[model samples]
Target: MSILTQSAAFIARSCARLLAQDCLLCAADSRSSLLCTACADDLPRLPADYCPRCALPTPAGEVCGRCLRQAPHYDAA
Candidate 1:
């Protein structure tokens, strides 16, 4: 990208960072990130036992039944 474009993008991002102090979800005051700490903590997270390839939640570390029966499109995730 051109230097002018890069500078404009940087300035825009800086302005957005300055202006985006409220959480997007609850409109609560956020320190740095888009979401407040409470909202961030409340977000749904994938289980630690999820399949590495398809990211499907598994009881154990082994591949999920579906993936074991039929491999996913991607070789590695």
Candidate 2:
């Protein structure tokens, strides 16, 4: 690998080792994965069933009456 890339990798590794914490989801460089345990378990994950337009939770995979009428403009690609 290139010298600059190697140096950057080394620096990242050193930083992670200096700040290892159980609650903190970190690796030898950056976040271990998408969501840490504390965040994953504590934070609410958006359910599969949600309003497509409003991006709000829904039970039957259909937009709520309010959204259907007013329409939420937050749906995205």
Best by TM-score: 1
Give candidate 1 regions above 4 Å deviation: 1-20, 75-77
Candidate 1 local lDDT, residue 65: 84
Best by lDDT: 1
List the candidates' TM-scores in order. 0.61, 0.48
**CA lDDT scores, all candidates in order:** 0.86, 0.67
Query: After TM-score superposition, what is the CA distance of residue 56 in candidate 1 from its true location, in Å?
Result: 1.6
Q: List the residue pairs that clash in candidate 2.
A: none
The sequence of per-residue lDDT tens digits that candidate 2 reaches over residues 1-77 is: 99999999998888777754444444323344455655667776678988767767889768867787876666631
Q: RMSD of candidate 1 to the true fold?
A: 6.2
Worst 10 contiguous positions by lDDT, candidate 2:
21-30
